[model samples]
Target chain A: MTMFTRSDKVSETGGGAKPPARDDTPAPAEAKRPQATAQPLSHTAPPPPPKAAASTVSVISKALKITGQLESTEDIQIDGMVDGDVRGVSVTVGGDAKIKGTVYGEEVKLSGTVDGKIEAQRVVLTSTAHMSGDVVHQNIKIEAGAFINGHCRPDFGKPESKALPPPHKPAAAPPEQKRDAVVGAP
Target chain B: MSALSLSSLVKPPRRDDAEELPVSHLGRALTVRGVLDTEGEIRVHGKVLGRINADCLVLDTGGLVEGDIVARDVRVSGRLNGRIFALHVTLDSSADITGRVFHHTLTMAKGARVEGRMPWRPLNYFETLEQLPETRQ
Candidate 1:
C-alpha cells in the first residue's frame, strides 16, 4: 500500500520536482563547466596563428643569410643573400638580394644580382637586374636597364641537340660561308 | 611595445637593431639544408636540416628541424630532433621534441612531449656561449 502511494506521488510531482533538482544540480555543474571550457580554450587558442602564418609564401627577409640550398614547391621571395642554389616554382629576387649559385625555377623574376646561372622556363630580368652568368629559358624578357654579361639561350627544353650548335655555328659559319661564295664565283 | 623594450633591455648590447629586423618565414613546402643566420626572428614552418642561429626562433606547427638551435628566445610548437641552447624556452602543447634543451628558463604546456634531459643553467651560461662544446656532437 505505501509503495503504491509513493508511486502516485512521484507521478504527480515529476514535472514540478525536476526544476528544483535541476536548480540544485546547476550550481555545481556551472562551476565545472567554466573550468572544462577554459582548459580547452587555453589549449587551443595559441596554435591557430602559427598555422596560418605557416601556410603562406615564404619570405627570406633582408636580415637573413642562408649558406646552402633552398628547395621549395611553393613561391619564395628572397631579399637577402644566398650563397647556394635556390629551386622554387615562382622565384622573386628582390632588388637588394644576391645569389651566388644557380637558380632553378618554373618562373624566375630577377631584379637583383645573380652571379650564377638561371635555368627556368620563363625568365624576366627587370631594370635593376644584374646577371653575370648564362640564362637558359624558353621565354625571356630583358628590361632596358638590365645588365647581362653572359649568353641568353632559348634552348630550355632540349639540352643536348641545341647546346653545342649555337656557339660553334655563330663563330665558324660566317667565314665558311664567305669562302664558299668566293670559290663558287671563281 | 613594452615587451620589446623590456627584452631589449635584457638582451645584450651588441644587437640594438634586433627589434627592427624583419622576421623571416620559411613556408611549409620549403626545405632548407644549410645554416640560417639572422639577427631578428625566424619562424620555421618547413623542414630545416641544418643549424639555426637567431635572436628569436619559433618552430611552428608541422615544422621539422634536425639540427642545433642557438637563440635567445625559443618557442616550439613543432618537432625537433636536435639540441637547443636558449635563454628562454617555451614548449607549446603540440611540440614533439627529442633532444636536450639547455635553457635558463623553461615553460612547457600540458601535452608537450619531450624525450631528453632539460638541464637548467644560469643566465651567464647563455651569455658566454660563443662556441658550443665539442664534447657532445
Candidate 2:
C-alpha cells in the first residue's frame, strides 16, 4: 500500500527493480542523494515517482522511548514506550508497546498498554491490549481476552447521523465526516 | 590512526551488527519527536527531534535530526542540530551539523559544514558513555 510514503523511502530504488524503460538510465547502485541521479535523466523532469520500496512506515523499535508528540501522515508501528500523544493514519501498538497519551488515527490496532484515550475510525483491541482510557471508534473488533477499562463509543462522526435513517449512507459519509471531525476536534 | 580508535577495540564493530538486526527506515514525509533506541541500524530520511540511540545511524540527504544521538557509528549527510556521541563518525559533503561530536575516529567529506567541536576520545571513553553529557540551555 502506497498510503503515505515518500518518493525515496529506500535507497535501493536507485538500483534494481526499476521499470523496463528506466533501465537505460545510469543510476547509482547506492545513491546517497537520489535526487541528484534522478534529476538529469528525465528531460521533462517530472516529479520522482514513489515506488513500493519507498516505504514511509516509521517503526518504533522495542528499545526506543519517546517523550514528545509524534505526528505522521504515513503508517506508524510502535513497539516501544511513548509518553506523549501520537497522530497517524495507521497506528499499530505492538505487543510490548506502551503509550501513555492520546492516540489519534484512521485505524488503531492495539496489542499492548495504552494509558490514555484512543480516537480512530476503526479500533481493534487484541487479546494483549490493556487500555486505561476511553475509546472512540466507528467500527470495533474486540477480542475476548482483551482488557479495557474505558467507555467504548461508536460515535466518531456526526453523532445525530448515527440515528438518522438510510442505512446505505453508512458506506459513504462516515469516513468523510470522521476525518472532518478529527480535524475539527483537534 | 586506527590504533587509538574504538573500531579497533570493538571486535565485531557496529556495522557488523547492522547486518544481523532489523533496520528501521523513516521516509522523508515522517516527523518524530521523542527518543529512539535500537540495536539495529536506522536510516533517517525524515525529520527527528529528539534523542536517538542506535548501533549505526545514517542520515540521508534532505533529512534533518534535532537532538542528541548516541550511536556506535554515525553518518550524517543532511542537517543536524544536536550533540553526537559515537565511536566512528562520517560527515558527508551535504552535511550541515551544528553541535558537539564526541568520536574516536572521524571522516569528513570536502564540503561538509560542521560548526562545533569534535573531541576525540579513547575507546574506553565511548564504552563508558552510558549517558550523554548535559546540554547547555
Candidate 3:
C-alpha cells in the first residue's frame, strides 16, 4: 500500500519515479561537465607580434677563443680554440680547432685537436684530427690519415648521417666538344 | 622523560633497508628546489626562481623562466632572466633573454634579443668581412 502511494506521488509529480521536478528546470547532464585534459589551455588574450623563424642556424668556429662552455641546437663548425665543454646536435671541428674540453653531440665530425672526451651518437675522425680522449659513440668512422689516441667501441647501430662526397655537377658543355676545344685552344 | 632502553625499544631502520628513492616530480615542472637531472626533454612554461639542471631543455613560446639553467641542449622561444650553461643553445625569434649564456654552439634568430657574452665564435668570412668595412671607416 505504501509503495502504491509512493508510485502515485511519483506519477503525480513527474513521469518517472526518480525525483520531483523543482521549478520545472532541467538539470545539467553530468557528462557535459567541464573536465581537464592533457592539452594546454589557450588564452583568449590578444595575440603577440609574430617573430622570425630560424629553421637552420650555423656557427662558423674560426679564431674564436672561448674560456667557458659552448653549446647549440643546430649545426656548428669549430675552427677556433675552446677551453671548456662543447656540445651541439651536429658538430664539425675544422683543422684549426684546438679544443681542450669534452665534446657532446648527436654527430661529430673531427678534423682538429681534442684533449678531452668525445661523446655522441656518431663520431667521424678525418685525417687531420688529433684526438687524445675517450670516444663514446654508437658509430665511429676513422679516415685513413686520421690520428686518434682514444678508446673506441663502435656500436654501428645508430641513427646518424655519414660523411659522403659532395654532389657531382653536370658538365656545362658536351664532353667531346670541350675536349676538342681544349686540344685546339692550347 | 624516563631513561630509554636500547634492547627493549625498537630501533630506527638501518641505512641498508632504506632505499635510494627519487622524488616523483624531480624532473617535472619548474621545480627549483632540487636538481632536475633528466635524460629526456624538459619544457618550461612557467617561472623558475632557482637553479635547474637537465639534459635537454626547451622553453616553449610564452614561457617565462628566471633562474640558472644547466643542460646539454637548451632552446628558448620565450623570456629568460638568468644564467644558462649548456653544451648548445638556440635562441629563437620569440626569445628575450638577459643574462650570461655559456655554450659550445650558440645561435640567435633574427628578432631574438640577447644581452650576454658568446664564448666562442667560429670563423665566418662574410660576417668578418662585413665588420671590416665599418671598422676601417
Rank order (by DockQ, best first)? 1, 2, 3
What order do you get sorting by TM-score, best first?
1, 2, 3
lDDT of 3 by residue, A1-186 (tens): 999999888777766544454323233221221221111321111111223342233333342344556555556666656667876778888898788888888899999999998988889999999999888888889999988886885533443334222232234346778899999998
Better of 1 and 3 by DockQ: 1
| Fnat of model 3, as a fraction | 0.00
Model 1: residues with Cα > 4 Å off, grouped in runs: A1-53, A161-186, B1-16, B134-137
Show model 2 residue runs off by greater than 4 Å: A1-54, A158-186, B1-21, B128-137
- lDDT of each candidate versus the true structure: 0.81, 0.75, 0.57
* lDDT tens per residue, model 2, A1-186: 453354455535744566653543424322433443243321111112223255678887665566788888989998877889999999999998999999999999999999999999999999999999999899999998999998998877646554776677787888999999999997
State each model's C-alpha RMSD to the native. 11.6, 16.8, 25.5
Candidate 1 structure quality by residue, lDDT tens digits, A81-146: 898999999999999899999999999999999999999999999999999999999999999999
Those runs of model 3 whose alpha carbons end farther than 4 Å from true positions after fitting are A1-55, A155-186, B1-137
Per-residue lDDT of B1-137 in model 3, one digit per residue for the tens?
11111121112223332222111111112222223333333455543455554444676566566776755557788788887765457677689889877654565666888887655523232124224442232
Q: Candidate 2 docking category?
A: incorrect
lDDT of 3 at B56: 49
Model 1 TM-score on a 0 to 1 scale? 0.73
- Scanning candidate 1 chain B in windows of ten residues, the lowest lDDT window is B1-10
TM-score winner among the candidates? 1
Query: What TM-score, to 2 decimals, does candidate 3 have?
Result: 0.35
